[model samples]
Target: MSATPADRIQLTGLRAQGRHGVYDFERARGQEFVVDAVLELDLTPAARTDDVADTVHYGELAERLVAVVAGEPVDLIETLADRLLAVCLADPRVDVATVTVHKPEAPVPHTFSDVAVTMTRRRAR
Candidate 1:
């Protein structure tokens, strides 16, 4: 059997304040955006060698993700998710990236727990 997507690094609840919405008030004041990402990569090399270089550095990855979220102003969470996917895929070793962007403060008529967008991308061969 082939390796499953279970081989991955997961990061959750990554919060960053950003201006990402269609509403003018949202862009002006900004709101908290949460991120959850799963970086798919083989862990065998790192496990065998016991070396940091053999695997993805999650700390740096988190920082890079934060930069993307807090940097530019996008109109939709889908686009934000795409930008985040790019960041994960930037590491050649990452075979796939599954990301979710959550907006808890979305303007809605009714009470809602959250609004989010999730996407999964595979590296091009």
Candidate 2:
């Protein structure tokens, strides 16, 4: 059987400051953006070889993801999430990648928890 989404590596709660929003104030005063990502890939190679080379190095992945959050300014978290998914799927081993971008400081008139965008992408065969 092929690797399914169930077989995954999850990275969560990565925080970064980014200027992303529709309003000018939001862009001027950057807010924290939290990210969560799930990568689906076959772990058997790594397991069998016990080699880091066979698997995704999460430290490297984290750095890349954080760079995206801090690199460019976008109007929507959805676009940010899409960019993250692109990063996640850059590896040939990864079959699917799911990313969520959280904006805790979203401008809202009422009390709320958070606003976020989630996106998933699958590699082509």
Among the numbered candidates, top TM-score falls to 1
In candidate 2, what are the lDDT values of residues 1-125, reduced to their tens digit? 45765689999999988888889998898989999999999998988999999989988999999999888888888988998998999998999899989999999999999888888888888
lDDT of each: 0.92, 0.90
Clashing pairs for predicted structure model 2, backbone only: none
Error of 2 at 45 (Å): 0.6
lDDT string, candidate 1, 37-108, tens digits: 998888888889999998899999999999999988999999999999999999988888999999999988
Regions of model 2 farther than 4 Å from truth: none
Q: Clashes in model 1: which pairs?
A: none
